[model samples]
Target: MAQTTAVSSTHRLWIGAQAWALRRLSAFSRAPRTAPHLETGTRGEREALFHLRRLGYTIVAHRWRTPKLRGDVDLVAGHGHTLCIVEVKTRTRRDAVPAELAVDPDKQRILRRLARAYLHRLPPRAREAPVRFDVISIYLESSPTSTPAPSIQLNIELNQGAFGWA
Candidate 1:
């Protein structure tokens, strides 16, 4: 039993190391962010990581992409037996249309393709696990205060099974 536990712990550590390396490689390849929206998105993804962990989700990847694919998945997580392909949308303010609505039919199609690519790269066991599409909307609002530099408050919403493979 002790041997089994040690092997499990080592396996988990290896997976964590691989995920960290992937994130670092992605950051090195991506250009610097200057736009306000881009900055907001970066912050949103960071916040989303914490939010998902609080919900008992194990993050598998961040900014996952395939060389042949044109787009990237904002986050990939696992909850129970389900594999979650997460898309994150961030805005300075909530618009008339909900942020989740942005994952329209067109966007859903793209995500589906990306998910397929991601699954192909996974090991046989995980590749066959159930897959789910999730969307996380983050709205950043400035808190009303007397201070010159008002703090930003984040409103995060997680929509599990946001879309279907069909």
Candidate 2:
């Protein structure tokens, strides 16, 4: 016997979500609000971090804040002697732009600075370890109808000698 779930009587989601999104998009299309937009991104980032940990990375931070720049690195993890500073971007297939495309030059510069800050904050023994910058992009074929996991695609673009100079 297989487990079957009965459809709930009250299940109108898109109608509600569309209205919410429309209201949000309309209200701040001019000045732009940061808080609400981050809600969706945070969920995706957490999911990405989960997947990364499953594949053997030890997570160090989720959203490490800094005074100079206010942004997140999504997931920071370590593997063996290498300290991996990962930038996670998640997107659906419907979007023409891919997730990794989110990390632009400005974003890269900030991430680098944050990585340095993170290193600086670490204890002396940990700070001596090698640091690498990795960009992990997750593309999901996600929709309101799916109970199963998204068709997750990961593209890991790592700058091998990221902090070799320093």
Candidate 3:
């Protein structure tokens, strides 16, 4: 049990390290702010991506930044049959507002626009491939453990094969 706890702690720290590296790279590229919320979002995205992989998704791209949209797709993935363009939104808790509600209709529209642009960039065959838009919400309901407080659970929901668009 002690070993298991140690391993879990190590894994969390490693995840933090990975986020730190990404933040550093983005900084070097002269990107915008790397606030704690950004780190939290990135971390949540990574966790969501891992869950998708475990459930049989092949990640093709990540953090695909664009100028016109000025946004990012947390993960571009495929699940054997259809290409999945995923939007990840992370929240620390589910208080009056839930995590899934963060991706508003306007945000979905932006995602659709970017998804079309992404499809246009592919070859004809690839462009014609079946595609889907999905939203993965990562709800982290725990406080930082530099100190101890209450326990928080993580919830990852994949709105798989989300068919409609704005």
Candidate 4:
């Protein structure tokens, strides 16, 4: 009976430690506040990370940028044998258009260039792997005035192979 109690106490301590680690990780991952729009985008990226993990993706990088590049990739994930370069767009309810539509031709061109730069830095074998571009559009619905701000609803749309190489 004493041995069983000791095991139970050890399990509880392990679970508590896991919870504490998760809390610290979350706090560290949170972006600093800036413009409201940037904050919304940061929140959307967090949401996207959760959504993709739920869908069985292994996220390799977040906000990946090279010293030679001016822009950054929102997320890099692996699905099967494909390397996905993702772009995340977040907008509030006030926006009339779908956020994915924001990745216009000019943006696609820039993303392709960045992708090339990313692949060039990889090992030759890894660089030969298939590549795909994806876009995640997140629409945040404002809560009712009576409801707390933390309860905002998110509508996320994932567009795989959103565009081809330029």
lDDT of 3 by residue, 48-157 (tens): 87666656677899988678775777799987767889988888877687666677877777778888888878889898777788888888888567656665578887
Tens-digit lDDT string for candidate 1 (1-166): 0001123545556655654575567556666667877777887887687667656678889999999988899999988778889999988888899999999999999999999999998888878898999999988888889999787787999888888999
Candidate 3 TM-score, true structure as reference: 0.72
* Per-model TM against the reference: 0.79, 0.62, 0.72, 0.78
Cα lDDT, model 2, residue 154: 36
- List the lowest-lDDT window of 10 residues for candidate 1: 1-10
- Per lDDT, what order, best first? 1, 4, 3, 2
lDDT of 4 by residue, 85-150 (tens): 999998887466788999999888888988999999899999988899999998888777765545
List the candidate 2 regions with Cα displacement exceeding 4 Å. Answer: 1-37, 94-96, 143-166
Instruction: For candidate 1, list the clashing residue pairs, or say none.
Output: none
Candidate 4 CA-lDDT value? 0.80
**Which candidate leads in lDDT?**
1
User: Candidate 4, TM-score vs. the true structure?
Assistant: 0.78
User: In order, what lDDT does every prediction score?
Assistant: 0.82, 0.62, 0.74, 0.80
Among all windows of ten consecutive residues in candidate 4, which has the lowest summed lDDT? 1-10
Off by over 4 Å in 4: 1-32, 148-150
lDDT, candidate 3, at 148: 65
